[model samples]
Target: MDSSSPAQGAARSADLAALDVRITGCRACPRLVAWREEVAATKRAAFADQTYWGRPVPGFGPPDAPLLVVGLAPAAHGGNRTGRMFTGDRSGDVLYAALHDIGLASRGTSVRADDGLELYGVRVTSPVHCAPPANKPTPGERDTCRPWLVRELGLLRPTLRAVVVLGAFGWQAALPALTEAGWAVPRPRPAFAHGARVTLVRRPEPDAPGTGPASAELFGCFHVSQRNTFTGRLTPAMLRQVLATAAESAGLPTRSPWTS
Candidate 1:
């Protein structure tokens, strides 16, 4: 291994850590702030003894990860409760199980922030950091939270090679963020569909460095929400298929779902 690799990795980790801190501290959207706080204070009956994260949830995973999983926003009772994206939620249960089958996740369940879950060459995040009411964030709130995504994209450019966006909302939100982060999104922006795929190239700059990946593949998959999963619109095998493809495109090794 090259001596510079460790140093570079450390620097990237530090940058992302700083970003997460800033993300958790954000209160840019008044309505989201109020709603998340109210939900946190209400204390769900099952979790009354536990403390709530209550603040904006930051993206979870390693800084130099090669794959990105994008979702709509934090769940009011899930991430807003555990301080971790996707944790303590049914959606997270399905997604993580699929990821584990694809060899991108360390475990099949993500129940809490301290659950020892780990992701391999993949990072999970959402367009909006704060949980929204009725599981919907206003378009205005989405726009307000975009800069964080843009910054995260920029930070991950060095190693990022693929992105799997769950749901239309995240797809729409990610395009502008990716563009702002240096990728040249095609004109007539592509529509979102389960199993859809697109390749995005980095916009050329006068002094563009050649040390990092110049392009990233983007895949679309249905969100792992109860509505989709329960209705069989997105099955475990189907979700794993998309994630496996994205993982391979990101240059990460994946295990076949059919294997033990």
Candidate 2:
């Protein structure tokens, strides 16, 4: 749905809230939670008593969105601290600005959820629901979290048009999962880079009763991490180009969210 419409936005917000409620209290990985709690406690004072979300971070976007943006995981002081994907951090600053410029974001500000930020035809989520130590999740932990992503993709079914992986890690994590679920693999299996677009084609018809591919497009690009952006690895122009390709694949205009 487009931002020019109001009713569609309201419906999508409710859908996102439903997903958020389901995992808001999750403690599926005790080790991760314990570590998260410890970090939160240690930083609570330094953070001026800002309480941690300390729970599973949920994906946010339109339920039937054509584009899905996959990120690595929650940052300890970002999503983990603020309870919203890509919020309260430098990484989010880069991401939200690009999204806003691309028309996927309604509000340019992503410092906090209360800022009234909204995603239009795109949805943003991470492979790991919980924040990990030093932002690094173990292989086992990532595997354990795969089911949640599977369920989310299924729920957003039928309308999914393109998938944008925001980093090599996210690409590595999600590509196999999408392949296993029957989506086509990108020709040459795109390596993560700024403005790189790998076209994944899903058949107009269902798999031939047994062995066929699911219908979907897959895109990849370098993440808008602090390291990437601050170091000039991912430039603003590069991010815009990548998003423009993503929107084109999803059959949307690319007027850019930043200009408005």
Candidate 3:
């Protein structure tokens, strides 16, 4: 499919169910395909007996979320193993805990896709769906995976108003996809920094009625990687502050007082 074709956009804009089916079946990048499968086959010691999802991990959470959380890619033994973004990993532990504390997540831990943990007014996704070798995706691989994200943004345009990008990689990758999906990105784009914010107004499109030029804000946060969390580069308070800000900007309900 032509990444920019109207048909592709229509397909992705259908619904999360359709988009998910396409995402998991993707084998567009040879390197990613081999690496994800290789890791699944070899298996991590602790999860040796568990069956790995071994495919592209789809974004998870409410379909009509007002907020979107974008990450770099799946980890070798994390999302790639569990078929859910951020699941089965330290990074997910940090992220979901904050979301839970802030009232966006139903639970503080996401061990598997069926963990009964639901997100309120929020969704989690990544720039690259498949796990890359050494936790890094080549520029070519990133570009190749761009369409899926672009289409996803298009689908979520109606309600999405705030995006929290984790780390510089997700920030860089998100700009083009947002632009392609019709958000008016600024020239010489705003540099990525912790807590940095940029607002982009959606562009009017004939096919996209009732969705003309709605504004969305982007907020930056340090990746919830073990490297950053363990070093105190990104603390629970720091991440929660960013999420609270983004949620407010999206007009999501205030976090429940009972949440902790």
Clashes of each: 0, 7, 1
**Tens-digit per-residue lDDT, 1-260, candidate 1:** 11122223323344788778778877778898899999999978999999999998989999999999999999988999999999999999999999998788999999999999999899999999999999999898898788778888888988999999999999999999999988988889999999999999987655657846889999999999999999999988889889999898888998884742
What TM-score would each prediction reach against the true structure? 0.93, 0.83, 0.93
* Segments of candidate 1 deviating more than 4 angstroms: 1-14, 205-208
After aligning candidate 2 to the native by TM-score, how far in Å is the CA of 246 from where it should be? 0.1
Count of clashing pairs, candidate 2: 7
What is the TM-score of candidate 3? 0.93
Q: lDDT tens string, model 3, 1-260?
A: 23233236336547887887778878888899999999999999999999999998989988899999999999999999999999999999999998998888989999998889899999999989999998999988888888889888988888999999999999999999999988999999988999999999888878766762279999999999999999999998899999999999998875644423
lDDT at 183 for candidate 1?
Answer: 92
Off by over 4 Å in 3: 1-13, 256-260
RMSD of each: 6.1, 7.5, 2.7
Ranking by TM-score: 3, 1, 2
Worst 10 residues of 2 by lDDT: 1-10
Better of 1 and 2 by TM-score: 1
lDDT of 2 by residue, 152-216 (tens): 66555567777888888788788766664446676566677655566565534353443322456
